[model samples]
Target: MKTNPPAVQIVAISADEAGQRIDNFLRTQLKGVPKSMIYRILRKGEVRVNKKRIKPEYKLVAGDEIRIPPVRVAERDEQTVSPKLAKVASLADAILYEDDWILVMNKPSGTAVHGGSGLSFGVIEGLRALRPEARFLELVHRLDRDTSGVLLVAKKRSALRSLHEQLREKGMQKDYLALVRGSWPSHLKVVQAPLLKNILQSGERVVRVNSEGKPSETRFKVEERYAHATLVKASPVTGRTHQIRVHTLHAGHPIAFDDRYGEQEFDRQLATTGLNRLFLHAAALTFTHPNSGEVMRMEAPLDERLKQCLKVLRQQAQ
Candidate 1:
């Protein structure tokens, strides 16, 4: 007698999904599968991205192949999960991009990458709970806890691999919009600085510029101006920790609502501006498809907070 091989789920990926994780991909695909079970399978080498067993947090690129094992039910003595996980799982309906290989969400501010330090649940954790059979789901890039827009998630490992290469080559382009201080001096400007890590006693040990730091750069241009400030469009040429935030301050003009590096007095004046969520947004992104080499672009609409701030600014001008 011959035995049959377990049914496999195979998928091909694309580049618009350049930055996503493996585990997050599966959760979206297999909305019925539980996160704990998926994590267990990944740890045991049951899932493969291009035939290599990748961790749950493995980043994805396009054109890679994925293999998923047959699902099986196993009784475990694990404890019950928290209700917050269940709540986050329901947010999957907000997906902006989805294919066999990936799904990207417009990640809102105030969310963490994963559950750690103090957060027991994040966008990824909740998504995993909702997607069960998806063999992989992963985050391609990261956003600050208080920054909103254009978050990427990979549906499979192969897709993760293809998308990542574009990021490495700097073929991916991302643009941001911010309400900043003062009239920008130039129509086009690039802020080049070196970043160093500071060991802080209480606040975040953030990356800052110093004499002995890594080289970083950001480009900026004016979009509009307020009575005491300027609304600028900014782009980062190199992906570094806090590259934009640090460079903006390094130029003596901080973002309007920056709570950390922002001028407190300026932030206070902008209070009526209704810019509650750090005045930074991932406005647009463009990159070559990892699979087809075709160019792809995705834009995030201005959220309510920013819109409200714009309304106030316009009203103030009138």
Candidate 2:
């Protein structure tokens, strides 16, 4: 006979759970519930924090009260771990920094930040599996799965809030390295374009330049010029979805190997060169430490595969 867990439940946040997002908290607590259903309940105010309805991004603090309504949860199968998640866990060597309040990682290209849409699990889920004793952990910001570099995660709710404030105030700086097709112009250093995001009929997301779009900016500086492609550093002034990628396209120099918003022929040619992924890397990040109040700068080196692609290009240039 199978019995449901309970009709209603109340939980008090502890120190371990203090810095997590409410959505993440619910996911951990209601392990068998579909993520969509959890988000749906959150949208309907079926879940509350401190007796008030809160948005999904609301971070939990110590002693906070969470109210959970009834929902059918599938029985747990404690014995199984998804292979993809296990692989992500195994790659924990990429973690760059860790402390009581935050974690910094060099997330690899092709690994999603969190599981959804189609992925089974990503860095967050992998970290959860890697550190089962951790009470709270949540991404402070996101890097596109194909963009490898310094990724931040908060261990405490206060830290997450502080970091969020930094991002909102433009105090956080992120720099990226991209290999773009064609020779980059020495004088073309800035891309100030408003970008609008659209959803295609297939439910795929695409970004384009539009007068109605939000203000976006990216600063570009040449790193190295190759015969047919250029290595450059891209610093985004305003964070928007695919801002750098789309802005690069607008500059008439689409990033090498970008499947979306890229030159298809160039991508196919790069593919033959053994460059299989988008040539975008989150090379560095700068922000004030949430706990220490000290400005911190983190960097992630280019992976061997990306380095190899550059090596090939450099050889051809020579």
Candidate 3:
């Protein structure tokens, strides 16, 4: 089950107006929410600046985002707040697949799986509200914030339990599409390494290859090549956290557009090629139906922006 994330909707508080701090500006924008609630979200990391969370006194940039985590609202007041929530509610309702027991979505690049670090609401909560009849709706898995593609959600408690069991038992197949940093070796490389996570003092977490960590495996195959990089299909046989991201990096072909786990020279090369938003997508997923005994496969169509970027990069190569 997912809860409402911390978040705030943006309204113009003019640059010429009395200097109001970011939290104060939120106090102005969200009329009914309490100041104490605002402070709690900030401290817990549910609210973010841009997409990154910040300190309580962080100055207001003209276009900064102030996320308000979800509040326990009076159902009676929903009508009253609907007007204020119209924009986000509409955008958050996008669905990729829906059935009585399952839901899948083509999540956008900037949204999180659920809220924290000051997000008021995330896609999951918005979806849950839109389908309240569901006894339970749980994310079957996760994708990174800046990577877009298919995500699965289970709509019933039984379904969620069964699906999660399948994942734990390694009864699922996951395939990803990644535009990578450099021309890949023509031969396929199946990186079998263990991943160890490191959390920095600043509260960010990243993963690295370590002999003592959880065993991980990634099968990488070149799909196509550009002058400087290659588009590869990565299939993970094991799902330790950040398995694919770390494996690809260890293979010497880090994913293009990856903000973390990317090498510096390759990151710069990606910018020159006009690639953005970590060129990775949950392209296909296969698992057994939690309700039925049959197999199911799900795929997401390539979004056009990535396609256009590839076309331009191919042109540059020529």
Candidate number achieving the greatest lDDT relative to the actual structure = 2
Question: What is the lDDT, from 0 to 100, of the residue 160 in candidate 1?
Answer: 82
Alpha carbon lDDT of each predicted model: 0.75, 0.86, 0.74
- List the candidates ranked by lDDT, beginning with the highest: 2, 1, 3
- Residue-by-residue lDDT tens digits, candidate 2, 1-318: 976577889999999989998988998898766554566688678999989998767899999999999887444532364566447544566777767788899998988999887877788987776655568899999988888889999988999999999999999999999999888999988999999999999878899999999999999999998878889999998999999999999989999878897898777756545788899999999999998899999999999999998888877778
Model 1 CA RMSD to the hidden true structure, in angstroms: 10.4
How well does candidate 1 score on lDDT at residue 286? Answer: 86
User: Candidate 3 — which residues are off by over 4 angstroms?
Assistant: 1-93
TM, every model: 0.71, 0.73, 0.70
Report the number of clashing residue pairs per model: 39, 2, 28
Off by over 4 Å in 1: 1-90, 201-203
> Which residue segments of model 2 deviate by more than 4 Å?
1-82
lDDT of 2 at 83: 65
RMSD of each: 10.4, 11.5, 15.5
lDDT at position 47, candidate 2: 97
Top model by TM-score, which number? 2
lDDT of candidate 3?
0.74
* lDDT at position 279, candidate 1: 82
Model 2 lDDT at residue 223: 96
Please, what are the lDDT tens digits per residue for candidate 1 over residues 10-109?
Answer: 8776796547898788877665666556666786788898999887778888987878888744334123444675456435545566556666677666
